[model samples]
Target: MPSSVCIMEDPPVDRLTSPILKKYYPCPNASPGYFSLRHKFRSLFQLPRIHASELPVQQNKPVSPADALTAAAESLQKKVVQNKSLISEVEIQQFLSSETGSDRLKRMYTKDVDGFQSPELWFIGQSLLKICGMTFLITSYIGGKHGGEKFAKENQATAFRTQFQASRLRNDHVVLAGMKSGFIWTYRVGIFSSIFLFLSQSIAVYRNKSSVMEYVIASGVTGSLLKANLGPKGMMSGGVFGSLMGLVGGTLIYGFMLMTNETQEQRHYWNIQKYLEVQRELNKGGD
Candidate 1:
């Protein structure tokens, strides 16, 4: 049994050398502790080592057509909900009937009046007052003292006759003749004044460049001046020139007053109509 004694010892390091095995071996000059600790840490944690093929490749996510449509519908519904009561009829009516609305209407138009008010009386009074003042100025100032005296003397007889038979003055042949002449002159002045005022107001409205009241006043002044300068003379001379001016001035003034008043009233009516329209719209709902 003691024929052969085989020997077992560590393999020669130099004889077992290989390039791949070299990595597993410690460097000849390096400390073995450093490599030992690194190996121990890597083994303890078992940290994952990544490879290019193992990485997740990112790609754009696909959107379904139905999902997009659903999103659009949701957005549309949100908008509709937000604007649901935007044109409410009740709200519009309340706004129009409010104090603020009344104030605005007042500024744009005229006062709202109920019951009976005599526009006829207002026109007549304005006409007469304006005529009286105009007559005095033209006869006394513009006509000169001598012309004024002549007018007074001529009218003196008519004046006396009027005083005695005031009721008959409208019918008496002599007085009627005088009145006829006066009426002709008055008619001419009134017509001219009316034309001037109408044209002025119409132009202002058409252009929207000037205020209606401004044109009214201009027409008034111009009519008065024209009456004073170019008014007729002869039998109706005494204080009559200024009277003619007043007549014309009154015609324009009163006419304009009535016109503006009526216009304002119409505006108020129109606003009421607009309110009704808004109410109708609100009733329709969900536009």
Candidate 2:
């Protein structure tokens, strides 16, 4: 009998439809070129392809109940294999860098961030946030207490305006006297612009739709303006930039008063007169 003819062909793919087969899904010893290809081959039989965002994405392989226990055991074995110092620098650093997967993840994140903030400060902030709904306490005090929640809060904005004026006058006196005490003293050079930006933010919060957004925008403006006022070195290193910042600050703050509506007391006094006239007419009608 004649030997049977052997036919071999390259496996057909969606992109390449060829009867001639050069290789299977992956050639033996083929470089793990793309991560996608490596992962694809690893779970090619286990995972299902799903259409997502117009891309063919592989969904997670379904794990059997037995597989879950097996995985958990493997995880425990991995934990055992990891080397851990009895006591570590991690403890001194206020965090644990252990064999624990969660700790490792946290350590990685902290490393990437380059030690963002102090734990002590974080605790203090948490305590204050819980004690008072003061998300922007630092901001409130910096503006000479002329703006923020006190002034433009709860439709009692008139109260805020009066308080703000009083605060500005106090700061003006401080600046004129060269009285450097507290934040006012420390940031005295830019105090003028400080007041102005405060008033602007306050007005925006009270009159505009979103107070938070106004302040967020204000913060960016304030930082730039503050830098201009202080310059590279700062107040004692007072340059032309510092002088300009102070001038701008003063103009903005007092100008806001000139631009806005009348004080609450003045408006109330006018309304009272109208009320008295109405009362007199009602009494006359009864008579």
Candidate 3:
């Protein structure tokens, strides 16, 4: 009878209601909160990031025409409006008063026939000298007399000449050939220089540098060293490459020197010029 009574009393069920059990039991239903908020919190702590190798990578989506147009419009608007950050009034006045700044500003705004010609002629002369210098240095180091003789022979064979019968008959063919060889070599040097300038322009943009001067210097130095390593046969090829680099470096240095004296007006002009270029690029993409 005692056993039956004890069983019926629920065997001290209140003992199961101890604070420790009660605390763990019921597990207060964790109200499933915002999944996105939880995910964000996880990300913030870098706690549950999926490994890159765990999932298939999705390819980058191509930018749509509408997105491109919107980007261009934004750029154009940003540029057209005066951005005081790019050019301030105090800086402009200072640049305008400076000799170098004045000259650069003039060149940008007004057409000066002489201004363009002077610089062009100077560059041409420099290129010619560079070609001659490289040819001498490389040949002297390698084949010595033999290399000189070979160059002469090649020049004589390949030199430019008049197509007219009368000119071809002249006894001065050798002299004309030599002159043509010089001209051809000069033209090659010029071409290499132009290529360097174009490449460095892209580099400057990529680096977000205010000046392309550093690229120019680095290219020339690298090209010279590389050419020197190639021996005598590389004279023509290496010289052209080196000259191109030199021109770029020289131009960068020169431009920076001038930019040092830039005033408020000069800054404003350059800012506008940069924006216009951005607009042109945007237009190209739209088309």
What TM-score goes with each of the models?
Answer: 0.23, 0.17, 0.27
Error of 3 at 159 (Å): 26
Show the colliding residue pairs in model 2.
9-21, 10-20, 10-21, 151-160, 180-185, 192-249, 193-249
Q: Model 1, poorest ten-residue lDDT window?
A: 1-10
RMSD (CA, angstroms), candidate 1: 29.0
What are the per-residue Cα lDDT tens digits for candidate 2 across 123-156? 3345544433332334335453443333334344
Model 1, runs deviating above 4 Å: 1-174, 208-287
Best by TM-score: 3
Candidate 1 colliding pairs: 134-242, 135-242, 135-243
Candidate 2 deviant stretches above 4 angstroms: 1-193, 196-207, 229-287
Q: What's the lDDT for candidate 2?
A: 0.42
lDDT of each: 0.49, 0.42, 0.50
1-287 per-residue lDDT for model 3 (tens digits): 33222111111234444565334333343222433345456557665668879999889989999999999999977885744334445654554445353344344344333334223234445765676667545443443344355545655666455546433433245444445565555555545555554444334333424354545554664465457657765755765676575666667665774678543234445644554455556665678
Which runs of model 3 end up more than 4 angstroms from their true locations? 1-171, 210-213, 216-218, 221-252, 259-287
Residues 108-191 of candidate 1 have per-residue lDDT tens digits of: 333223333233234334665576446444443433444434555566656544455643433354443444445555556555
Candidate ranking under TM-score, highest first, comes to 3, 1, 2
